[model samples]
Target chain A: MYQALFFLFAASAVGFAINLLIQRHPIHSALSLIGVMGSLASLYLMLGAEFLAVVQVIVYAGAVMVLFVFVIMLLNADKEEPSDRSKMAKYLGLPLLFLLLAMITVVIYRQFPEDAMVQFGDFPGQTAAIGRLLFRDFLLPFEVISILILIAIIGAIVLAKKEP
Target chain B: MPPAVILFTLVKILLLLVVLLTAVAYAVLFERKVVARMQSRWGPTRVGPHGLLQPLADAVKLLTKEDITPSSAFRFIYTMAPLLSLVFALLAFAVIPFGPPLTLGGVDAFQVADPDIGLLFLFAVSSMGVYGITLAGWSSNSKYSLLGSLRSTAQMISYELAVGLSVIGVLLMTGSLSLRTIVDAQAGTYWGFLPRWHVFPQIVGFFCFYVGAIAETNRLPFDMPEAETELVAGYHTEYSSMKFAMFFMAEYANMVAVSCVATVLFFGGWHGPLFGPPSLQVVLPLFWFALKVFCFLFVYVWLRGTLPRFRYDQLMAFGWKFLMPVALGNVILTSFVIVAWPALSRFWS
Candidate 1:
């Protein structure tokens, strides 16, 4: 059941990511990203990261993607003009992406040579459990991240504000 | 857990969908009648007895009408918008506990899906509702639709902050994210007379929530996105027939869903005065829940009738400048009270 659910969500997530890349219109691309987020959220749920899954939907899919969609709409973003970047960028970008992916894969492989299977309900991600870990264990990082978000918000407001 | 359980759940889902759709239909009629009466006019009496059959007639008319799709519209997104709205509006009902969970024949059954993150789930789905209106407006390829949709997106997104913050007070008091648990927390009474509704202590939260919900559902005073006179029916200006009906039905469904959530969150959901036999006890709670929900729906209509709509700037200013701060303050005050309750109790004793 876990494998089936994983495959389902993973397939859709990949599909949506591809769709995001291929979509001509910015709105469609934004929607595809939202779909990817939603599928990722479901996968998170299946992995028993309930809080993370909800947060993924609320923060990423609900809030972040809405902002993306809003911007796309506000600008009335047209279809992508054919890539006008230099040949160096085109040649280097793909290989660089692949290199990055390979490095991540290698790192993950080295971290856990024998990949453990994800059994359902193996790790409970209850809100209370996550809250404890966040506040107690990852307290400094959490506070720093929150401060970073506050800074970003202030930056956005400042940037977007009228000249007056 | 078992085949019987699955069967029961399926049955329950079917039952709920039908009941909810019917309720949505009547809610429209109820709104129309109430609003008309407020304006000293009879509403839809020609359709059936006191317009009781008006929803049915309207449904038929909508179904029979031509579903117009403009040549300039984004066809795919245009088609998806109303469905998206309706689905999200209905989805929240799944987590809302209509009555107490019942245990019968060694089977536990109550709401559709009582996830631990039910409140978050509700918010997540509701937040996504913006997409429908946004898409509808953009896809319509009309200036009015574009303007309306933009206003809606901003309004809903802004007001949702207040809505989420206000709910924190109740959640802090209850210390649970589950709607069922929140209801259970507010089950009993203070002094054995007054029901322990969160509204008493979280009055500001309740006010914020009510106002936020009104705005969220895009009802009167906050219905800037669909301001008929200003935007030619707003984001749905280009839509016709069943597509238009879908948007209309979606609005009413959203109203009902928000009301249901409000009832569960603030009022003692399904927790009311009870008398008579065990059989009666089982049903009375559902009655009280429905009654509370009805009151909320009525208030929505009443507000629509009484209040004139706010300008776009006024609406945004109200949501951001006023509602947001008040909601934030309410949360802070509630949290402080909760934190200091022990010391305060010691002094009182």
Candidate 2:
């Protein structure tokens, strides 16, 4: 069941992304982007990252998407004419996408050992275990990442706001 | 390898999925009713016995409604966005420990999948929900939708830090990442009366989490994404019918997810007073869990009534400057206290 779900998610992600690239309208492309995020979140679940999955949906789908929609409306990007994909660009892009997909498939097929299937077990205290790891072992890096995020927040504000 | 075990687990998964989907349906009704009361009117009374059947009606309406795809829009992406949102929302509930594992027909039954990295899985899936809104807004090719998506993204990213940090205190006290273990760790009491709920030791963490959760859900005060006066329905402006309903469903599901996490971390999930009876031990824990979750849900509703919408800048500033720093400081203080007092660690153990 898990394996089937994983493959379904990956296939949906790749298919929707390809569709997104081929779509003429920006709106359609944006919607396809959502499909990509969803598939990724599902993949995370298959990898045993429950908290990451929730965070992915809440932060990425719920909040970030809202912002994307806001910007789409603010810019009135929907009314703009859909630009046709140039033949030259398509020639260059198609191979790149195929190469990326092939690489991903190879990596998955190679890295994941068949015998490495995760067995369900006692999961009590998993959050606490993560907490200990984050605070004790990964404390310095975690703090640094947070600071970097803070900087990003500031940068976003500066970029979004109108200059005085 | 037992056939019975496999059958039982499959049944359990199906059952839980039904319950969760049902809960998602009712949560929407609950929100509408509560919001109506706040606005000085009875909500959904005409549906079924004070609108009890309103969700079913709404679902039918949505399913039957016209599903329009914009001519210029990205058809594949636009269709996929809502499905992605709904899928991730459903996924987050898989690891949530609804009640203690119960024995059914000689088999031990628990919630859905219980992966070792359950909490992280929830976080990752929840974060992925952003893509749905972003895609919806962008694919709609509408300015209003884009602006809404942008606000939602910024808000979620900013508050997620505080939300993650707030749970550190509970993690420190419990020393387990598993939802079941966290509840088990808090099963008893300290000083005979004070239950070992993390809320006492991690009050600051709780406050930060509470605020961040509200932002994460795009509830009042942090609902810049759907600021009707300004953004005009935000990211889902261009979405109609079932596609729009999917986003609605995701919001309520996310709310429940956060509430469950808060219950486990700070409210001593499924842990209540033991009356020294064996039967009570089995039933009371589930009751406690339900009570805690209900209280959090009530608080969610209450906040909607009590607080006004926050200015976008103020919301961003508060999340980054106030909540983040406080959460960080609390973590430091907790670590210091744990290290300084060996007795405290011993007491928890």
Candidate 3:
């Protein structure tokens, strides 16, 4: 049952990703990205990282994507102008895709045995467990990443400011 | 999954929706009546007795009214926006526990589901509601709508940070995000009188959170999106008929949801004195919960009647320059107390 559910979400995630790339209008593309984020969040839920899943939805799909959509609206971006597909890309794109898929499959096959799989709902990574790991074990790394993000935010603010 | 469990969940969801929708409809009327008295005006006297059936009348009118779609508007998004708004607004209720659990269930009987991160789930759902307003304004292809959407997006985004941050102090006290657990933590009273609610110590947090909640719902004093003086009905300017009704429904539903959360967080949820028979025990907690939520709704209306709307710049400045800093300070204070509190008490002893 879990496997079936996982496959369904996985398929949808990839499908939405492709749709995101192919959508002409920026808003639709943003919506498709949100779909991809949502499906991936579901996949994370199935993988037993419930906190990660919710955070994924709240941060990426909810907040970040809203900003992207807001920008699209603000700019009033219209449909993309159609571009001619290059002859080299048209001939070789499919072959390259299949080649990449085959290489990824081979790498996966060699990395682990088929029986090594995620036990459904086994590792219920509840909030407390993740908190202990974050604050106690990996506190430094977490703080470092947070500081890095804060710096980036300050940088953006500084950059966005106009000259007096 | 068991079919029985699924069936029961569906039944629970249906029950919740019916009660919630009816409550939201009446909440609008409640606001109108309360605000009317405050403003010294007779509001909707003709529709039913004392505007009792006014919500029903409004529903029928909106449903029967013509839905006009602009020629240049993005038809798909314009139509879907209100649904998105209302759905996410309603989704938060799934995790809200109205009362204590019955013996029949492992979790609270009044709540639909109690995930570990129930509070965060509510924030997430509420945050997603911004999309509806954003899309509605953007897809309308009208200048007023675009402007309103811009202000809304900025206002909601800025206030949301304060809202999220303001609740950290409560979480620090309860040590759990689950609404049921948080309420349970506030089970007993302090000094045999005052309820051991988080609101007492976390007053600043509660204040910030309440303000942020008001902003999040786009209520008066913070309602830049559709302030009638500047923007013509804001994001819903191009929306008409039932679609228009849906947006209002979303706003009211959001108000109820925020009220419920405040009751759960600051007010001790469903934790009142029990009296009467065992059968009445089950109903009494629900009564207390509803009473608390109703008071919140009443206060919401009172504020609308009393306060003038903030200017757009003032709104942003209040949320960021003042509210955010205060919320952050509250968080820091709460955490410091939590860590050093026991030792400090020991030192005094």
Candidate 4:
């Protein structure tokens, strides 16, 4: 059952990612990206990281993708016609993308062996455990990241403040 | 995984769907009746006794109406949007605990599914629920649709933060995100007098949560997206017939979902007085839950009739500046109280 669910979501994730690239309308692409995020969230659930799965959907698919779709809608963006400026991305970017994918696959394979299986409820990366980890084990990194987010918020406020 | 578990889940899902659809239908009737009374007029008295059969009539009318597609509209997304909205709206209920856990033939059978992150799952689904309105507007290829969607996207995004943050106070007190655990935590009474509901201690959080929920659901005082005078029915301006009915149902369903969440989070969910035989005890929780939910639906309609629509700027300012800060402060206060709780008790003793 686990493997079946894993294969289903993983295939959908890849399919949606490809569709995101191929779709002409920006809104279609944005929706495809959301699809990818949702499928990836399911894969995260299969990994026993329930907290991560919900956060992935809530933060990325729910909030960020809404903004993406919102922008596409607000601008009334039309289908993309490739401009002369995108030559490098169309052809040259393929090899780089493949290399990145390969690198990630290699890292994952090395980290997880066949015996390192994903039995759904075996590992507990639940909210409380994750909380303890962030507040106790990785407190400095967490605080630093929060401070960075605070700085970003301040910067955004400054940028949004209209100049007289 | 097992066949029994799967069967029970399927049964639960079917039952919840029926209950949810019925709730949505009656909520509409309830709103119309109450709003009419507030305006010193009769509402839907012609259909059945006290408008009991009104929802049935509405369903028949909507289902039989012509589903017109605008000439220039984006057909696929336009058609898909309302279903998306409705599916996500109903999906949130799968995780919500309707009553205490009940087992039938050795299978846990009350909730559809109880993941460790059930509460967060609700948030995730609701956040995604914005897409229905957004896409419907964008796909309609109409200016009104675009404009209405623009407001909804902005409003939902802005209020989503406040809503999520407000609930953190409840999470802190309960120390868990599962709706079942949250309900369990609120069971019994404080000092044998006051109900041990989060509402008593986290009143500020409840305030922010309820207000944000109203905004998120686009109810009165925050329903800028659908202001008839300005936007001409907002995102659903181009929708007609069953398509329009879907959006309408989605709106009422979303309202029910939020109200259920409010009841579970703040009020003691199904924690009222219990008595009588075992069978009655089993069902009284459901009764209390339905009663509380009815009260919430009444309040929602009451506000709709009583309060005027907010100016768009006022809505944004209220959500971002006032509600967000207050919710953040409530979270801080809750965490502080929880952390210093032991010391405070020691001091008292």
- Two-chain DockQ for each candidate model: 0.81, 0.33, 0.79, 0.87
Residues A1-164 of candidate 2 have per-residue lDDT tens digits of: 77788789989999988988787655556657767877887776566565555566656755566556546655656434656969887788879879999999899879998677655333332344666789999999999999999999999999999978
- lDDT preference between candidates 2 and 4, better one: 4
Model 4 TM-score, 2 decimals: 0.96
DockQ of model 1, rounded to 2 decimals? 0.81
Order of all candidates by lDDT, from best down to worst?
3, 1, 4, 2
DockQ score for model 2, please? 0.33
Off by over 4 Å in 3: B103-108
Please give the range of 10 consecutive residues that has the lowest summed lDDT in model 2 chain A. A119-128
Highest DockQ scorer: 4
- The residue-by-residue lDDT of candidate 2 on B48-106, one tens digit each, is 89999999999999999997777767676778778878887788777888778787865
Q: Name every residue pair that clashes in candidate 3.
A: none
Tens-place lDDT per residue, model 3, A6-68, is 999999999999999898999999999998999998998887788888999899988999899
iRMS, candidate 3, in Å: value is 0.8
Cand 1, B chain, TM: 0.98
Q: Which 10-residue span in candidate 3 chain B carries the lowest summed lDDT?
A: B101-110
Q: Count the backbone clashes (under 3 Å) in each candidate.
A: 0, 100, 0, 0
Interface RMSD of each: 0.8, 5.4, 0.8, 0.7
Please give, for residues B69-157, the per-residue lDDT of candidate 4 as tens digits.
Answer: 99999999999999999999999998888888888866566678888799999999999999999999999999988899899999999
lDDT of each: 0.91, 0.79, 0.92, 0.91
Q: How far is B227's C-alpha from truth in model 4 (Å)?
A: 0.4
